[model samples]
Target: MGDGLRLALTTYSVNPRGGVVHTLELAEALQAAGVLVTVVALSDQGKGFFREVGVPVRLIDAPAPAPTLEERVFQSIATLTEYLGEIGDQFDIVHSQDCISARAAARIRDAGTSYRVIRTVHHVDDFTTQALMDCQRNAILEPDDVLVVSKLWQDLLLKDYGVHAGIVTNGIRAERFSAGISELRRKELRQKLGVDDRFVYLTVGGIEPRKGTAYLVEALARLKATHPNPPMLAIIGGHSFQDYRAYRESVLDSLEPSGLELGKDVVLLGTVSDAELPEWFSAADGFAFPSMKEGWGLVVLEAMAAGLPVVTSDIDVFHEFLTDEDDALMTNAGDAASLAQGLARLVDDEETRRRLAQHGPTVAARYPWSATAEQHLEVYRRALNAR
Candidate 1:
């Protein structure tokens, strides 16, 4: 405990999704606390996710590309496992953030004589494909100690696979996002994005079944009845390592409706740079997240930190950190009417919006990266000592 914990983190992608973001921040925080840290990921892209970052990303590029997700999954595991030869033996705690990395970590641990493997199940996916399902099962069960972002995910692990995962909730960079932008910066960002005096209802997750992209489109369309001058919906996300490009396009085909029109009212800004993300959050009037499922809705915390009034899905994972009326407005994910009403409440009521915004920064401030790193260290120490 005096010197440091030798921690090596493995994430599924060298991309800017919530899990990868968590891995980067946690590694840096631990490094600051005097721990020796290394990060590894399976790479499909040539560029690293961060521009100017402290921790160096070690990307294990696959030898040959695959046509489907199943093949990609196998290739990622094989590539990372083979590459693990160089870095796997140097750490006391080898933690994985996703399934592919978990499989790779297990392979490394089984082959090598050193290091303990722990898997952080960001969220449990009910995958239809057999290969993907087996990958998830092996990833969860093979690890020594499992970690999850929310109790809901932990409960899911227990019910479905009978594995109990430790709950180390996801953190937000509150100081990074919680700070208000200058009026000049705000005006510049608004003009640059071509978003006029419109009240922007922002959603950040890319199009997917779990993300409920279709449901939010319907809800935004339904909001037209109550909020006549409806907010233009801005979705800012890209496809992750998952092969969801086809899924995204299929969901987009369903977007043309009464109130929501693509290229006009509904703007799809596919993934903003990390440096510019806070500004995008600052420019928004409201944050809308109608996800069918979530581990802990990291974007919701980020929106709250930025002091935006939130209208998110009323899932159990969200309920873990956020209150019904106190943190943000919550709506049933399946019901478009309920979701519409939630967004309408935020749009119509100025006082309620102010209430959520004012209290949100305070809530976000409580879960900094330091706190998250501390929880991770506690678990790491327990694992090391037990070994």
Candidate 2:
């Protein structure tokens, strides 16, 4: 392995979305660890965030004005080829996130450059037939080291797509998520949210179909019916429904007739700034995330780090980091009754919640960004050796 790796990280967009945040956090951590890192993005939304964190960012041409159906295919190939041809020689390793950048990185590797190509699969769905067609078509020609965030994703890549990938779980910055907030700040946050002394159930993620927000709402409704002192559920993060708008609308419509007060019982605060997020986690009594599909549930670790008990889905990926009836309470994904039961256990039993909260931070400490970056450094070395 070289003395210090010069890494070129590529992604479609550097927006403040979950995947973008993962890329930025990893890049910043790697740079702090003395690795020379350059972030290359197709869009500029997250450029400021990266620069503010002291990471060098390069934004490619303005995404070529959102292409139509016929133009989309040709434009994708052209844009990727153009970007790689222009900047492929500047680094020792090209680490790509998401499918588009993966294909681009593969193309650069195929060009016979000295730079080694590496790709990280943030989500298993990225390897689906319709999702990563370009990568599938060119993967054989453009061989590169693949990295996946979860064992579930790694297995999907190997079993479904026959692609070998190294596993590097996503991590959070523990210091930033620590429970050292002043009492004044906590009180201010609670006052701002109108959350008095009642227990709060918090879930943070985009409001999308895959995120299972509707399931969360149904569970909250169920909890209200059964429990005398039901905690309020606060959902953070905003999303575009687009074609899925009908489902979101239907869920809202159903909630209206369910006899549950919106602000009183359930509140959807949409997107929140990163600074405001920790206080939300700190104020919450327990965390509930019953997402049906996720590449990595980084929020679960964040909640745990904030000293909040977690109630999450019993999926293979989630189980890889959290155990059933241990650090987190696992419930059936997309099942409102199961989710409600899981939340009820945490709500009704204060001692159990306290016990889980006490143990949660210890488990979360194992997944700091430094460890995750070290793992990626190893992968970069392997890619460079292969080259």
Backbone clashes per model, in order? 0, 0
**Candidate 2: tens digits of C-alpha lDDT, residues 180-239:** 578888788667667788778888875667778888888888888877777788888763
Among the numbered candidates, top TM-score falls to 1
Error of 1 at 193 (Å): 4.4
Which residue pairs in candidate 2 have backbone atoms (N, alpha carbon, C) closer than 3 angstroms, thus clashing? none
Write one digit per residue (lDDT tens) for candidate 1, span 128-205.
Answer: 798899888999999999999888888888999999899996888887887778888988877655677778888887
Off by over 4 Å in 1: none
lDDT of each: 0.83, 0.76
| Candidate 2 residue-wise lDDT at 209 | 73
